[model samples]
Target: MNYKPTLIFGRISIAISLLLIVSLLFIDCNSDRLADIKETEEILRKADASIQNSITQKNIDSLMSFYAEDACLLPTAEPKVEGKAAIKREWQHIFEIPDFNNKSTLTKIEISKDGSMAYTMGTYLATMQGEDGSPVEEPGKWVTVWEKQSDGHWLIVVDTYNTDIPPPDHK
Candidate 1:
């Protein structure tokens, strides 16, 4: 047996094995990251569904439960509403409207790599009694920022929405 040939083959085999190990490690890291993203997405989806349910049921407490203590709400043509108490008050006012109905469909949700923060953009359709007690429908878009708390629950930290169509006076 030629010693040179044997040594060269042994070195090549070691290099190939190292490369495979590194590749496997990289793939495992990526797999974990993907799983985290999927989990975050699912959490956001469930939260969105719960929010819609609360709105449909006109449950102000349930709706406020989805928000963080320091959350902010930026409503259309209105000043920013901040904190849980303020947000609760805002929802209270809306829920008091006669025959108020609202629904939201999430279009996109993006989460950070660390799984600590996320943002969701969506569309909303709402119906409520107009001044004459007639049903009025308003279609709009919204964006919400979510943050993960120490309890491992995600809550909305910032929310904003605006109507797709301008008010009649604008036309």
Candidate 2:
């Protein structure tokens, strides 16, 4: 007599369980990716070094080579610079600044335990000539998220940074 309620409940539970299992099947467990953490980390570091060298030399083409096509730059006090083309334009403008110079030191490179993602944190010293022809140096911190592509290469996905000094509007 009471079997109807029990049967319905059992069916509902089974449906939910099946749904969860199917979802897991589609999820990226990353069990097969980045199995070699140390090697991957070293590769990432070398790629980052290439990026730094490009920046130091103000080489736009080389600098842009490390970014994903959909990469984004979260600049301070400005709208998000999105996509490869826009990001390239932004970097060009930055490189054109008077006496522009920058050096970034990566403090840490953390890879997810599951090897699904990696990111870097660092400090940068950016110097340029102010409107009054005076040297202005801004020491700042930055973080960059990286993603692995199907081609076995890592590329920058997101980059964000801000200076310690006050904003121009507040100054």
lDDT per residue (tens digit) for residues 33-92 in model 1: 999999899999999999999999988889889999999999998999999999999888
Q: For all candidates, what are the clash counts?
A: 0, 0
Model 2, position 66, has a per-residue lDDT of: 89
Candidate that would win on TM-score: 1
Clashes of 1: 0
Estimate every model's Cα lDDT from 0 to 1. 0.93, 0.89
> lDDT tens digits, residues 64-110, model 2?
99899999999989999999999999999999999999988989999
Residue 100, candidate 1: how far off, in angstroms?
1.1
